[model samples]
Target: MKKLKFTIEDKKIAELLGRQNFSTRESAIFELLKNCYDSGSKTCDIYIESNCIKIIDSGDGMNQDDIESNWMHVGKSNKGYKNEQNNRVLAGSKGVGRFALARLGNSAKVISKKEKEIAVIWETDWLTSGVKETSVDFSKGTIIEISDLRDIWRWKNVETLITFISRAYKGGDMKIHVHFEGETYNIYPIFEGIKMGENYVSKITMRYDSGKMRLSVTIESDEFRSEVKEIIKPISERYYEDVFDMINEIKKDEVEEPEQYLKELGDFSAELYFYLGRIGIGKEKFMYKHNEINKLDTGVILYRNAFSISSLDGKKDWLDIASRARLSPAAATHRTGNWRVRQNQLFGFVMIDKNKNPMLKDLANRQGLEEDEYYQLFKNIIGFGLSRFERYRQSIIKKIDDKNKIKNKQKENNKNLKHFLNKPTTVTKMSEKELVSLVDEIKDIQREAKEQSQAREESTKQHKYDVRILNVLATQGLRASAIAHELHNKRNSLESGYKNIIEALEEYGFWEELNSDEFTRVAYKNVPQTLERLEEINIKLIAFLDVILNKIEKNKFSQKIKSIKNSLEKIVETWSQQYTWLNFKLNIKNDKIGEFRITNDVLEVIFDNLILNSIQHNELKDKLIIKISVEINGNTINVEYGDNGIGLSKKYVKEPKRILEVHETSRDDGHGLGMWIVNNTLHMYEGEVVEIDGNQGFNMNFNLKG
Candidate 1:
């Protein structure tokens, strides 16, 4: 091999590193802060002067030899290679972090010292030459002064810069301060209450340990009674692949062992604070401030160690949450897809300890992680966690919206009532003759009111009767279907038994011998067993069919008074026979009850629908208990109907009246017309059902005019 040395151009390389290595001045500044952090700095300060910028840190500084070998070297760093730095994991690996100085300005001077050592001063003019070292007496800390400023430091830019530093330094021991003109800015104050917005505040914390990722999320709002907290384990390969494919447009190859891939990413924890916008619940003052901050800064930010990843900052949707929302609008929980917390609605930090995640490396540009399997898997895991948060947020928003809708409806009703009450009434001053005419007018008005009341009552009664009829018809249809199904099964069993008897007779040649003992046995004993079973099935079928036929035959509505007790007893008997699985208990205080104006057919319809609804809706885990207690108090009969089955949900309790609406049911097989019919039927008799307290199952009390 011939001895050959590649000559290098330092000026061109320096310019390239300055312009291409870092994306912006803010990113370059972040790199410098990382260095301070790695050096065990507890405080870092940035001073923006008219002509120059200076960065100072209270960290263990470098010596002459240390500066020459490490600080001056390009593309070579030992910071995160082994992880043995005073029990603190390093944030920088590439030596190019020093090139961040070059990105800032062409000339720079650094003065640094260790405890009980002479300070070393280094000067570098990238526009001209390399670094020069000297000695100086200074405290045990580092000070970097750049004289040639590259970019204009406007007030707005400085404000943004301070915000970036503050976000990066959150939850870290290090504190950063910025000085511009005469004003001083600290990082902590800017980030306070940054997560809360008008309608909602959300917090998500994720911890990774032993190949498992556990995420805990909390959503809170004044609109709701309690905050919701959920802990989730994100470990499914299919979930990761689904989210990954959603963003990348190409499906990633499935990992054979996903747990192993998670292990490789190492232990890390991240906390995300999101503001849900004006629709969220909070004070207007704080909301205004939060909204302003949200406009400038929002995103799922990534931080290694405690320092933020530069390229992942400021409205960068690395998780692609917004895109997912747009793609599936209905799938989004908030009012609009944009209402979902996107990159611009969030501000947070992801903390990763380098010692645990030694393999997690950044790309050369320092924007984000290397596009390797481990990094991709890490992104997918975070995305999965966010997706879950979105879903929870949606549910919370829906609850809030429902409550708001009810409130709005109530307000509207009140407004209408107020308007009606406040309406102007006509008044006229009149003579004695006119006063006499007024008396006559008053009498006519009273008569009209009476007639209106009577008409309204009749209309209500007619509506109730119609509802009852519909409910009866529906219940009968269901019962008929059940009976038909049972009949078919019973007929099959009977036919099979008959076929077996005939086969036996033919096999033994019993039919040929008329008076033989074998023929007698077949004809009498075997044939009778089959016939007895058929008879029993036929009787049960006929009884069930008879109940349906009797109801249909007397379906015509009538005004004939009927005995309340007798009607209830008949309903109980019919239902008990039809639903042999159910247990019915009736406690009628007055067995010989007063006659009701309602007809027998109408009463039967109401009872049948209620019984059928109980059977169809209630969970038949045990012997379903149907209890009916009736007490005749004067002209009104107080009736209580209950069942010992799965009770109604709180939703139904809050709005019991909704249960009576047509086509409203919780059961998948229900026609939703049963309760409507029952309600209407009772209305005809000027009766109403009221929800009653019960330990188990659905219970209701109603009053009927007798």
Candidate 2:
């Protein structure tokens, strides 16, 4: 064997090749693209043939001498100069990218132009040396051709490609022209909508200048919502964590222009479209990232310099601006789309021009910028977008409320039907004697139950409206204390001011003594006035307390036993008002049913409580039905109340431990102490209350003995 004699420098190529593995063609192609970018090519074309792949560019082509010295050389590079005076910033690094082209193919050739009087062509073939080690040359203009493409081609994800391209488009001066087969792809900003085969496009521009920097944005109209959202979401979520935190020094009350912060973010445009082809690197693909704005369902496609890009998607999560408010399904999608539009990918595309100038350019070709404060004007609107997510949250809550209402409504209707079905009707068109007997018995039972119920009703009603003694004491005392504090401050100021005024009067010798009217005016204007105001406030405070007391009492005991007819009427009336649909039919089977002897107050309390509960708990919108029946057996009277309120939760019955007796504070919508009170009142009347669980409605029966 030759013993493989090799030097340390020779080992460098081996190391470089070992490090650059070609697992996927995407990794290699990216390297090639980077090379093109560094070489200052406005466009780089990639073509794959049967046995070879080629890349061509319009950059500075090298001469034979330059190719041998630089292009054919490995791991060596030159720092390129930038035309800073004209605001042209070139890519500063290049040597690292050449390896990609070498790693992707078995051979390469280059034709480039070096200044005037010089143009050269160079070629390296791995097939000959079995490695990327040699080079040969010809004439000018830059062209690199490598054969045996299978040496490095891999499948590419178009979506990711577009995203990468979109980011690179930030410079704005470069445009990528891709030719796959005979079809051509143009990678650039679609500030206006990008259309293929006669699609429509609209353009709009936005500008922001705060003196420090100026930004001008042009985008498509249909995609505005999506583009705007994408731009802002990052700012609101990442850049400004507690968006309010951005104003740390300013108190909430002091925020006169809350939009100021958002405006400072600069101006950008949003363009939406129906469709567009993709660009960029597979890993670096920003299409999905940008396309996310389109998912907002705003019906707008985003564009960057005439190319269709990203959109938004997903339910109205925290990203929605109107999330806290109820939104039509369509509107929710719209909000989400708009949010995505305001993102970095979309907004970042606008700072440079078609020629890649960082200085914001206008439609008029005017070189100046708009005032920075002008951009601040839209801050609140952006805040509104942030708030949309909250609005979605609120909408969900409302949905829950609506669902409960429907459930309760169904329950009430089913109960009503069951009760009506269960009750026994008059036996016949027979003699009066039989009908009268049945009638008498029912009346007797009802009358007895009503009387017994009255006692319980009276007890609860007595203090129903009374305020909680403790709360009244605390609230009144607090107000009084405030009044005292205010009066103390006033008195000090008044006394000092009054004394000075009197001294002035005495010095002027206008009067020998201060009169009551004059003294009163000064005191009223200063010290006593505060006290008087406090007194008025205290009076109002007492009145407010009284109102609370009244409400509490009403809640505890509206009426213990209301007449069955009246209770039924009220329930019917309420339902009628709420559901203007069908008029209800309530039949109190009381002919055999007597004027049930339940406390009109207690009965009313129970009836109203249940009715209100039904109204609040159900998710339906329809008229309600209720049926009541009274029966007597020896000394006991039984009264039944049933409705179609969505059936009671079996949990409430079977799991009494879990069922809240007081529904009010239960936070389960609006069931409250009324249920507790109803149950207790029944107990007070020496009665047992039984609930019947059904597939649809709830039924309750009270058996009382007087």
Candidate 3:
């Protein structure tokens, strides 16, 4: 075989490694800053003049040997390739980044001096620059002067460079100052901006040492007292079970101690700050800081040896946080699309060392980390921390929300009760600010609802009402504000209550909810409260419809006495079949079904309410059995109904008929309306329904007008 050596071309190689390494002009400059960081520089001062750029740093300067062996040598770097020195991990390892000077300018000069030696001057066309000894007075740091710029530099480019570099190094001991147009600006710590940045509502600290990961979050109580809560997940618990098992299968015998596989990731400490809130994100503070935060690129960032790593800035979702949140969202289900603790809501940094995490190396292009097995483990671990923080955040929020909901609901129920009872309510005079503040809070809750839900439409309407209230308060003072509160109550009653019931019943619409005097937008699926809400709204709507029906279309049989042969049986069968799991069985002990001059629909309200009450109140029973006894009096029909349930609610146990009043029962919706509807309809027909309490299950006795 003939011996042959390949020809080497320096200029083409320089172009390939230099200009081809970065995607933008700003990143080319960033590469130079990384050189300063690798050189142990504490402060890098950059100057941008008309067509020239100068970068000077304060650190231990390099000698002729370093310039020849490392800086001048192509494809040879020891910075991140080896171990850490003097408590610093190299921000860069490949020797190719220095050639980036060629990408920025045509000519570049380097001046460097050791603490005890004279200055060394070197110049290059980015391939092979000449070096000479100099007697010029110089400090112990490297200085680079680049001129003959290839592209026009604008102030916008300066701003972009500033933001790019600032996003890299989270405010640290190392400082960067840029001088442009005779103005010098010190880069500020990004996450700790003016208000929202400094005042994060929640913070989570995570550390991995040995083989275990430790996480703690600062939780604030309603009293504003803050305490750290330790989160302990078993080290054996795999965040990526399939990936781990697959890798384990690949390793087979080599992975004798499979549980210790996470140790390959080495150790790291991370601090995550939730900025949108706990720096106590209230409605007022959120509104004040929202615009400022929205303008910044915010996400979890990674740092190596206290220096920001390139390509891991906030602009990139390297951890896949936003997508993960958008996919699952967990407890943030009420808020659509994204989780409350997702990427944009957080400012975070993970500190890893190149020496400890040798495998977590940057890719050949220097754009990002190599997505290897260890890197996947690292990302999975970070995802675990985020999910835990999200859970903790949701738990705290729900606690506070439940407490507030109770208080707000109590006040509202009292107000609604007074309105229904025709009693005077104590309305206090309010200042414009207080009234506006109150309206803002209500709007805030509406805004808190998910956009895809009907709650959002309610939110929009409420917002318009809030704006009108504010406008009226601005003009009319306390008088207008006071009148607004009264209007709010009246509007809710008439619009939400009567209006909703009239539209819902299809066989009539949703006839069940008409019992209550107040209404709310319905839910997505069937719940225990659905039937209760339907009937309250239904009773009134049905009764009102009955009155209207009598006026327009007359039924000759509607006024005549009719025998109630199978009226109660059909209602029982429909409901019993509807809730098959309840295993309802109805027995009629009386031979004669009641006869009445009433319509079958009117008889339905009495038996239907009685049956609905049994189903609502019975939770512990395996099955419900209803026993009925019918009696035909001289001019009226009487019936006794009883069910095997948990019996009536405690308050209604004594005077169960009182449960027939609106908002009287334990059901979350206006359940009393259902019974109240039955009561009123029975009364007009010359029959009344009463409750039998202190009995097993529920018992009610009522009669029909004959």
Candidate 4:
């Protein structure tokens, strides 16, 4: 035999040949899969036993010369020029995938046969077992059985793995069978809406501040139909592109304030994309995108190599990664390999070298890509894709309009047909209440749609009755709380109030004694009185509702002040009961004070949080004097709420942010959300929350706008 030089050292060869350092064993497996993919395998079988991970592919089997020369070559090309399949250019071409088998297993065995009488057998231990190269003849296809698995990252739920893989590959024509812990999970494909036309794929729609744009793109597809959906699919594709373009164009437009549009677009589109895609992506055909995808029910999955990497970003605008809005390649893709990689961060990227080697970097640390260039590129590409879609959408709309004009004769027929097709059968007829509820739901849906479309006609959507209340308060300069109190007092005096309504029903011959005219008069007059009573009840109900809903609008100042008063009262009462050793009293400056137009919930939370802090944490034993006072000056409401308790640490006083953030509430003690809410609310109103300096006791000074 000719002398073999073997210039590469054995130790160096092992280090270079063994693919390791993957975060998970699943990733290592994906690397093995890429090896089979490069070998021109249409389908590869993965079998997982208790102690082994076996992979068998129908790709071309390698002979002894090929195995030793190419397979064992650490960084040699597996498929340099020929990697495309089904007109789709394969992403992995790196030779590093050969070492993936070793990364996932302690020992790997290969049984491959070319057109020869005998099959070839090659064995090698990943750790310290010298490369044992032998050649026997197998029947035909390559069979790779890797055993003695060390770090196989097996998923407890194979479904998770399948979902991950499906997203990674865009649900390509490949199949993934994950055999894990007694069950096998098969991953299917994910395609843009099947009902939606193929044109909708890779479209970008955006909503900025008050501007709305629909963008999409259309790739040529074989399937064509005259159905509305067929037309819609293409239109949607164009719309996706159109919307993205519109957002980009906003910056280029000569608007009076283009920056506003840019800022708003950046903020809003995150939600718009997530929700739109979520809703439009259907579950049954999760293969297709639909509206439900944005619902937060079926979370977004980032996938690589047919495995989920992280939770999908929700319907929220992200200023970061906005440039990636239109570039389809940058979006995550699926894998068919035994090894894959997954990432879950605001912005993440994985670079695969020409040799199929993967390297990852997260954009969160502000590494990789310049900021200005990043934004500009994002704007340009997304705009480009969107504008194309918009044009297509316009064309489709024109066609639909022209078709409608010619089909006037079949209008009724078409209406009937649409009704039959779109309407669903109900198990039971809806009651009037149910019908009314449905109407409310439909109205809400319409409102949400309008919001998504950037409908700016803010022509008061509140109830006329609600409007009257707002007008009365604004014009009369009467506080809502006082008005509520007045109404309650008035209702108490009237016989037709709650007390009288019950009395009337219990009265002697209440129904029969009244004539039709008298009964009608009572009913008519009672309407407003009834409404007034209801309003009184609503005042309380709305207050509670506001807390639950985080209602920022509607009687915010009064509600906030009231909540603070309530908290102070509770603190006083609690101290009186629990601490017999101490006495705490709240000194109120006035009956009605601090009319700051701030979020009621926030104000309440702030006061409650602060007061509770004083009671538990502050070293106040007896005669604790708490002052709840307010002063209004120059479009601002200055509040001085303090306690004669041990003041906060001096260090924390100087660095308020530190104290606000670091302070954790004991179970017995309330968390600092009260102070936080106060600080946050003050900040929202262009105000500040600071610990008053030169104070012996703990004093929180808050400035709020009226």
List TM-score per model, in order. Answer: 0.51, 0.32, 0.52, 0.36
Model 1 lDDT per residue over 358-466, tens place: 6677778667777677777766666555655665555454444444445445642333223334652322334566556556666655654664575466446544544
How far residue 145's Cα lies from its native spot in candidate 2, in Å, is 1.7
Ranking, lDDT, top scorer first: 1, 3, 4, 2
Off by over 4 Å in 4: 1-20, 83-91, 127-138, 152-157, 170-174, 180-184, 192-380, 383-706
- Candidate 1 Cα lDDT to native: 0.63
Best by lDDT: 1
In model 3, where do residues sit more than 4 Å from their true spots? 1-8, 80-86, 115-118, 126-128, 170-173, 191-198, 213-260, 277-296, 310-313, 329-340, 403-706
lDDT of 3 by residue, 1-706 (tens): 9999775566777677767776677777877887787777789999988889999987778788877887777778867443245465566777788877877888899899888987788898755568887765566898888899877888998988887777776536568899999999898666555232334544566666634433333332121222211111221111111111222112223234435555666777677666553332333311223322332455667777645664444687787867775444333322111133566676667778777777688766566788867777777666656655564444444344344445555643333324424643322454566556556655655644432254355345434533443355346544544554555455445346545545656357454544433343445344326755765654544443333343233453364424454666666666665565455444444434344355665766577777777777775567778777766766577777777777765544534554654334565443255665676566667676644664676777887565
Give the 10-residue window scoring lowest on summed lDDT in candidate 1: 237-246
The positional error of residue 662 in candidate 2, measured at the CA in angstroms, is 30
User: Deviation in angstroms for 428 in model 2?
Assistant: 26
Q: Number of clashes in model 3?
A: 29
lDDT of 2 by residue, 154-236 (tens): 23443444444443333455456655546556665433353422332223233434332333333332322232234333222
